[model samples]
Target chain A: MAYIPSMDLVPGVLKGDTRAVARLLSRAENGNEEGRPALEEIFKRAGRAHVVGITGVPGSGKSTLVAKLTAAIRASGRKVAIIAVDPSSPYSGGSILGDRIRMGELVGDKGVYVRSMATRGALGGLARGTLEAVDIVDAAGYDMVLIETVGVGQDEVDVARASHTTVVVSAPGLGDDIQAIKAGVLEIADIHVVSKCDKPDADRTISDLKNMLVLSLGLQPHVPAPLDVGARKAARWQVPVVPTSSVNDKGIEELLKEIDRHGRSLKESGEIVERQAAIAERRLVKASEEMLRDKLEERRGELSVLLKELAARRVSPHYAARKLLTESGFGGDK
Target chain B: MSVAQTKADRIRVIVAKVGLDGHDRGVKIVARTLRDAGMDVIYTGLHRTPEEVVEAAVQEDADVIGISILSGAHMTVFPKLLKLLKARGADDIKVMGGGVIPDEDVVKLKKMGVAEILLQDTPPAAIVDSVRRIVAERGAR
Candidate 1:
């Protein structure tokens, strides 16, 4: 039997012990009975690495894009950690596990570490325990972390909550995708990608993005978009609309440059710190909610009786909940 | 918590998606089947680094860790996971996986610390059986 440490492994990680780092991360994602105390220690040491979240439709060549991005980032001499999220069985709470096959080659590279996680019935479109996973990578000494979300729905904006930069990918000939994103999806993007630029319509997609950016920024169409107009100005619209073809490897370098530039902008604009603070705050609230949810479930038998009474019209759920809260010694007050 | 569990007894497994490729239908089915078979399955949801999956294995005290990879990243994800298992002192945990893998690579995966690789289109029962053998060999209580 392997010697299992009963203590948090953060100190070992800080000392550059990869094994300890890995062990702590595993514990974190398990949400094991011991996870919280372990994470509390690692959490204080996090925030050293840059986190990037990439999301797009399934057929949008996300894996290819990630492959190319990994190569580019690796070429720049940075160690990269990628967290790929795949679909999971809602019933069994496990994954179908296909993402790894697409990213095979990059896996062999010394500087790159790739991990796949199933979206195990987590609300908000991310896998449960993802932050803990990111903490593992961050603590593992990787300079950059890439989070890839399964592009099932628009709710993937949750990535933005954890990452310092959010990349939303779309392909040409996605006919109404641009229009679809306008409603709510596009707003979360720090950068937008027109993938598969080898196609003829890719340029038009880029133009459409420029137009959309102008409109969203509340600028006139005739007014050159901020990035284009300020191409020479010291101050510029940090956001860049990029065209990339993971197939031909076109525009990938430019895309990386844009991503790096945007990272700088996020820092220059003071958004990175603000966003990280918000993410941390959201994480605390989520942790508290999960803890509370477990507590409530522990009293499920009592709650069910109250719910049944409410259902029978003997009392309102709100009133009953309020009463329960009172009995539990909570005021339900702000 | 019986010493000898029925066929319906919960077989605890950790199903994880490894790498940046995001397809996961197969892993989900296996998790569901194993659960329906009365196994306790802990799913380390997406974007998990390999370390996270192994950590989950130890924490769940799982008898097995099932890795599903379709992103072509299996070469790195699996070997690293095994290495970490050994490094973190978890060589005893049975490691298995399946998903869009070529036969040649499956052989390679199995040689590299994976006890079994459940291929795409594999019958769900085969996966369950593989888990059963692995669990039995480990004398999982």
Candidate 2:
């Protein structure tokens, strides 16, 4: 069969066609220019699904928990989709997308769609076009969209910003340097999931996370914008540390309840609007940066003369950059 | 995108084992070898139904499906897989397999739309080269 053009598949995608959704995601990961318009159309239809991001240290049992969570979510009669990511070999550029190994439970369940993605050289624990992949699933009318990123350390916080609610999972033995993880990763969690709670020594990890949350709560002050003061008038949200034994299927239902509650709270507090704006700003900045990079690539030939000057130190790096931006109609100031 | 990945040379392959085969070592080896050759491989661990494997390939948009069966179900597995692929409008995603099959079954398998059948004795490098070739052929199609 000849491949279907992306634009021609837009209606299928909008109609929740699995094949179309899958095809579009592949194109996005490949960074195909032909898929751009289809993605644009698909993204405009997004924003209905609650985008939850799951990130934690490797071996934190992220994939297992995601599998359990998706199953529980389905039992509640909600259609859920998972974008599970695993790392690509830095050497081979190929990856063993083994999240499917753990997610095997969700297979053949029509209500739950799972797509295992290779990080494909995209960093920060996500695959290239991760957000776009989320949007594609979201546009397909999945009630809940879960993005499980490659296990991340302190600085891989991009998933937090890209998602409406971020769940940071940590196994009992993973976080030895609590302070280092706290400084970067802990604060990003809307919910802290202590997975592998069935194992011994789980109590200490739970207590430690709760203590960290309590300790951090008082130190970070909320700066309400003029418009946000009204939204902030709602009761301040507390980050909950939920411990779960995904292996035992214990606490799975309770965690789902908490997620539901959090969703309602976001809307009732009118903070969903604020979150939407912040997310929009982030997306705008990211998309603009993406465009700039593409433009830079296109103008590489034009940049050779400037590159020679740069190599000779005749023109400062800042001057050449500003000149190029201005000449490219980006309105960079002189 | 990560600067490490070379565009235009990557392929996504799903390496699966269907039926009651607990022997996954061979499939895992094939998966790893393909990965080393710079093809993304999704390993559908032991004992998947034909439904699960076909759905996986379509959902992952894989360029090829490599099934390793040691349970003597190649006759049933390959035809069913190809049928499901055709039914889902995904026969474009080529299918191949290998296992303890008699030589006669290999010829019949190929005649029934199975792209390539690797015997157990095939070299690891040959396995990678064949998959790479299959993916390139799909691209040309």
lDDT winner among the candidates?
A: 2
User: Candidate 1 DockQ category?
Assistant: incorrect
- Best TM-score goes to which candidate? 2
Report the error of model 1 at residue A93, Å. Answer: 1.7
How far is B84's C-alpha from truth in model 2 (Å)?
1.8
Fraction of native contacts, model 1 = 0.03
Model 2 lDDT tens row, A1-334: 6768989888987888888888888888777788899999988989999989899988888988998999989999999999998888888777898888887768888888888888766667777778889999999889999999998878787786677787888888655765568777766777889988988878989999999877766555563422232224223678888999977798888888878887888898777787788678767876787677667766777888999999999999999999999989898994
Model 1 chain A lowest lDDT segment of ten: A225-234
Model 2 docking tier (incorrect/acceptable/medium/high): medium
Q: Provide TM-scores for the models.
A: 0.73, 0.90
Local lDDT at A228 for model 2: 37
TM-score of chain B of 1: 0.89
Candidate 1 residue lDDT tens string, A1-334: 4435526466776664545655565565556675576676667777788888888877777767887998999999998877777765555544444555466566446567666555545555566677887887787688888888887455456777778777888888887876776645565677888899899898888888778776666543344532222221213444678888877788889978887887788678765666777688768877775555555555666777888898899998778878776665556543
TM-score of chain A for candidate 1? 0.86
Report residue A191 deviation for candidate 1 (angstroms): 0.9
